[model samples]
Target: MVHDILITKENPFENDVLNFRDHIHQFCSQFIFRKIPLSAVVGITGEWGTGKSTYLKMLQMHAEGKNKDVIYFNAWKYEFYEDPLIAIYFEMESKFKEVLTLKKYKKVLNDFKLYGTQFIKSVLINSISYVSEGIINLQDTKDNVKKIKEKQATLLEKRIEDLKGAKELVDRFSDSIATLAKIINENTDSPLIIIIDELDRCLPPHALKLLERIKHILSVPGVVFIIAYDKNQLSHSLKTLYGNDFNIEGYLIRIIDHEVAIPSLFSAEYFNKCADKVVLSNNIYIDKFDESYKGLNPFAVTNILMKLSLRDQQYIMHNIYSLNNKNKNITKISYLLVYFYFLGGLKLKNPSVFKLFESGTITKAEFYRKVLPALNPLERDEVIIGGAEILMAIVLTIISLIEGEQNPNNLTSLNLNGVNLEFNVHLVADVKTRMTTQRITNLKNIPKLYSEYPTFSLD
Candidate 1:
């Protein structure tokens, strides 16, 4: 039952071949504790589903062990709101409720609440007019003299100035932000680390607003922000929000102090480890297969795994484990199964070709032309491998089952392009003899192989 329950997500401490989690934690620690600048924005860049969020979780865990304050915020969770300032304000407030008693940080919390309300209101009411210089000719109408009326106008203008000058209003707003940052830093023992994840997942406006708000208004001395996203996506977002002429890289440079790319975690060693676990834990009899038949390019398989999420990885492994457990000789046909599962799972490639072939709607020549190239190319030295015969058997077995004829003897008699497929049929018969009816039925359904991994491609 080793494969019964796959690790749903990677553990922070689980070191892979790349030690990705450890490297992220180390970077966060070094950047946050720098002497000169107490506040910094660290950008963790990776394409979608490359596990940036998981790395942030590991960093949070490491920071917590050292008694540092960590605030994790998912921007996508509150993307429904028009204003990102509200999203950030509420997210911080929610986190504070869990960690610190409200009584101590009540004033600081209220400052955030008041400033957020005012900031939203200011954006909404964007056109406040300054006092005009024109004098009213109400000298005769008023009981007071003309000179007294003139003095009244000057006094009224001065009073209005005292109420709110444009510069004064902006300074007050900036002071409110500084107060909030100072109070939180002074109240907390360690520096506050804010991890903003899925920033790129937000809509173009929301993403740009969040970045702008963080860079301008919320930045403070004792706080550090780690923003996780795909740099390319965010750059595109900025261009969409701003014009095509926008200085995307320069704008990013102003916000992100240190940018680190998330490394590809699917090394050859890592995938081999995963394969060993799937095989041995499921009691799959892969050893009986000839070495050449079992051979596949690890690099190609690892590249396929890279395009998938951790969740997808777990799912495909579970399917393989279950299938191999049922059909003890499932490993014999795994060469094609691995490629077929991924191709069908992504569905970006041609899966219709397989369907046509299985239903006897396509010729063998058409199947070879359309489908074979999509599969991982075997090495030139391994041309004599029995994989081609096994592949043909797999196709014929499925074609027979889908046509309601599961008999191996009947399966071997299928004519492909006027040539007798006798040898391929025997290969199918040999493997089918070791499998149960249910196992063969499972293999008959090709979509079952694909249905588990989502058809959606991140690209």
Candidate 2:
């Protein structure tokens, strides 16, 4: 019973997993449909795989259920276009055709295409001018190129005219959208909710261009935008376009009327539920492993999973299944599970450190410095300071076993050449209680055990 590593984009509201349905409903009914201003841009900010896409889907579902017109635009999907406006225009055109008759939709959108073409042409002509400026200057005195400059001079005059008409083009485009929105509003009795999703996944240039177009052209009455993104990642994209010193918050404030942070989905109960979903088989070893670790603090596992993004959590869970399957013969199933879980987390969070640790080149001090800091504050506190006795026991037992120690039941400390790493007395006791003497003796090849699990790339 192998589970797929990726979670399907099924409507979580139907099942109400993670209890997000109430939050989604409240946000849609209270804020989005009722209180939010028409033509407002609402930003839904969260890290990647923190369920931004899922939340947006739920919002769209809820909004449509309430008879609101919703258009979901995935910007990253159509980012290959030279201009974001072109992609946006086509999406609106497609959606508008659904509500209005084909003739009426064509009539309303005719002016939009006319002005949109002019606007796009103006941008292209300007780019050509900028790129060919140097060559034009260098070839100015050549008799062969003099006519080219004269033609370009005439075209520059026309470009000046096009520049003057730029404002008109923008206004017509806006008017077309407003008219469509009004028709939709008249039919649905609600403003059109345009959800722009995956903006953070776009290339930096495309992302910034999309933001600018949204702010300038798409800001109109009778239309509201809900943009989902990872704020930090979008900030990085902005910094890549602008300098690192650019004020991202200031720029976003001008575009977004409201900012909504997706709530954290971390909890012990939720973690256990997700774990159960991945570890579906009722193998005797798995049952024994669960029973043995039932006394272990839930945070011990939760801390590791919570450190990963939601997507990475799924991957590690899948990895856990693989690890458990490969090491089913091992008697210390609980210890192996915890060890592999921590390793999978380390692999995802810091591949470089994981590589070093995997190569057996990382010392204990290096692990303390690199791996400990790689963990989040809660993970560090739990896995190092509080409720870390089991983890520490696993680490010490593995180290002692690898160093040719037959039974580490009484092993309290290790001398790593000059460095002394002490183990907690309780950790040794816990290890002894969980693992038999024979189990420790048999689990000599820690690296070999790790080798049984497949290697994977984060990318």
Candidate 3:
């Protein structure tokens, strides 16, 4: 079950979807072995759910095998903290001791450990933030005014003291990073590579602050930071912090030396890997699928799958398996219908339309209107109209029986636009819809839903 589990220990599927792994590995290897000035931040950016974390895990494995110091830090895990910078330092301190020899780097380890507790306290309790700069006017009694003025005077004095100590705190933090980098350079033969993941999942403030802190304080020459995130998302987050006019690319250029977008997973080989798993697991045959129908054609379907994330592809495969297991006779056609539902951006978005089809309330016109635009961009001559008509009618009959229509038993054939065909709708069992599709269109593009999501159907 590749659902919700992180691909940590195992390497990626190199002979399959992970063909991109070799290229990414070669890039990281070049950066490490070439010894072209370490301690720069490299970004592993991609859209959400595009196997960024999985790629990092593979990269971590590659680096570890080369004896490079590797730390896999998850930024989202510590987003609860007020200052993620403290959490960042703590994660590094915790991992360094585990990987490095204690006696060999005892003094440096101790220095790194010393700042963790004090920094936590300073961020949690003694931190001062800008409240307001405008003058205040109040209507109050003289005694109240006097007491407020005295309190302000005391607070102002304490703030001045805090401001005086702020420089010392920053110096201590910088010294620790520099000291750790130097000691690691001395003790270890390989560069220290820290892979920070899920930076995009952090809160807007935490994400921005973490990058700023890394740029200003923790930047050391021998330490290489590989951060995995969606750069577009991070840029949006930066805008949330510094207004719409924020120079996000400029800010990122200062922090990150190399920005690499995770390559797109768009290959027919990968699609076949997923499709083969789904079809064969249920003992279904590929030839039964209408190869002449462009949408169900394996190569044509691969084009649509290419646009989806790996997780989404899994979700679709799982759904197909679920649907296949419940029906026996028309297994091949059902696969096309399920895939088409997903390809056309149904199943998850527009439940009203989905429920119409599911509940057998979808009229012929409604089904045709909803499904036509989702078909492959081919002229009528390119598609086998006979296969398409028969397939659509078979799917409609299945929907009718699933919705528990009366006398739907012994349904052997279907008629579509005067084209008659044989089908086995009775083979479909009385199974209810199992999974609930959430409204995640805000987080993702729901296939063709945006431009093609429909309105109330008269039929």
Candidate 4:
């Protein structure tokens, strides 16, 4: 009989609760304790359902302990209709307004003499309209003067409508945060923190736009943005926008003045909390058996092992592959472990539960297929590459990135040496294709090996 591991902690990771606390503590210390608040832009990179949004929510809880006026937002499912920075600012102003009405913050609001309503309006309007004397006046319309007015009038009306709609949203956000910041600043005298969560699930294009928009967009200081993201997705995104010039390592450091990568290490105490909540509380495992979970990839091993009997625990734990593969030095098993860790975490949550059962216990296939190639799509876009399909599209885009965007016809067909292959091999090394296409002579003409096309992913 399968048993569900009960987790007592707030961890969304069904069974694995690791070193999230230290990460939160350290990140809070760096941003809150240090007053060096630059235009901090952080992108939380992770596969979808790595529980990044939950992690950010936890950070919001911790930030309160340090006297930061936290403004929390989930970009997923929201950034589609609205702009992110403007959305953030709107949230801030609203939070500020809310704080002003509180008895403790009322004095602060009065002292600053900040007319919350007006400040918010001006900020919103300023953000929306980039009107200059020349553009506003009849200056650049000498030739197409009549035509220019009609086009300009339509553009102006649309801009007005957009800004007006943004105004209502921003007004609410501004009122809440503006007053909140005023209150917090007045009451405790600390920098206000604005946390934007779920960049990975957010519209990637919108997220891409948000990164460009946030600098001048969120015109507030003393506001630290704790952006939670997974690096793999962030790199994938960076490659999409910046192309060959995408300097991911340098860019991450620059964007995040203070970056706190969810520490790779897992803590036993958090596990105790998890066991108390999920497994041990139900007496699924013996009291002493909890210690065996230590040193394993807290991301995967504990969750997988704890789900099975202690005997099965020994088997899964010993073979659990680490998903992280960027390091060339690590064993392939370790990297595969990272891959499985994420996939296992994924399975522990939702629909793919049966897939794990279908793949059989670890004894079935070890070398040929590391993790089961389920090819399942996640509900949330895989931050790793949005989702598999988006990732495929992005890979297609990058295929052209290596070969310039100018040519659209030959995209599907990759040439080996001088000639176009008999059939354009859209995707390669498909284990299914290997078996099916082995008999076909034309398969040799198509690109297959990673050695041939060094630029292809799997890097």
Models 1 onward score TM values of 0.61, 0.77, 0.69, 0.47
By TM-score: ranked, best first: 2, 3, 1, 4
Model 2 misplaced stretches (Cα beyond 4 Å): 1-12, 35-37, 101-127, 130-138, 142-153, 281-306, 321-332, 350-356, 361-374, 377-389, 404-407, 410-459
Question: How would you encode candidate 2's per-residue C-alpha lDDT over 121-150 as one tens digit per residue?
Answer: 766666665345543455455676768677
TM-score of 1: 0.61
- Give the lDDT of residue 385 in candidate 1: 27
Q: Ten-residue segment with the worst summed lDDT in candidate 3? A: 430-439
Number of the top-ranking candidate, with TM-score as the measure? 2
Report lDDT per candidate.
0.58, 0.66, 0.59, 0.44
- Poorest 10 consecutive residues by lDDT, candidate 1: 1-10
Q: Count clashing residue pairs in model 2.
A: 0
Supply candidate 2's per-residue lDDT for 139.
Answer: 44
Question: What lDDT is reached at residue 182 by model 2?
Answer: 76
Better of 1 and 2 by TM-score: 2
Top candidate by lDDT: 2
Ordered list by lDDT, greatest first: 2, 3, 1, 4
Model 3: per-residue lDDT, tens digit, 1-459?
Answer: 223323333443344364666666676765654443347888888997677886787777766665667778888888887787777776787777777676867877777677656666766666545233212235546768877677667777777887677657777866776667655655565566778998998889888888887777677777778899897888888899889999888888888989887777555466567667776666765554444333344333434423455655666556555545654433454443443434334554344566554443555457557654444432243234434433444445444433445344444554434444454342322111210121222112222332343332111
In model 4, what is the error at residue 52, expressed in angstroms?
4.1
Question: Model 4, 239-343: lDDT tens per residue?
Answer: 876796788788666556555556443244443453344333333332231232222333323343223222223222222211012222212222222333333
lDDT of 1 by residue, 1-459 (tens): 123212223344554433565586668557643332366788999876566776777777666665556788889988987677766766666765566566966776666566656766765454333223324444346575776668767867776775575345445555655555455556554456889998998899888888988887667666788899987888888888788888878988999988888875644454445556766565553333445444334223424423454445544555666655554444455534543444333343455764664344544456457655555443333321243334456555554554556574554443333333233445566555644344544555444444544333322
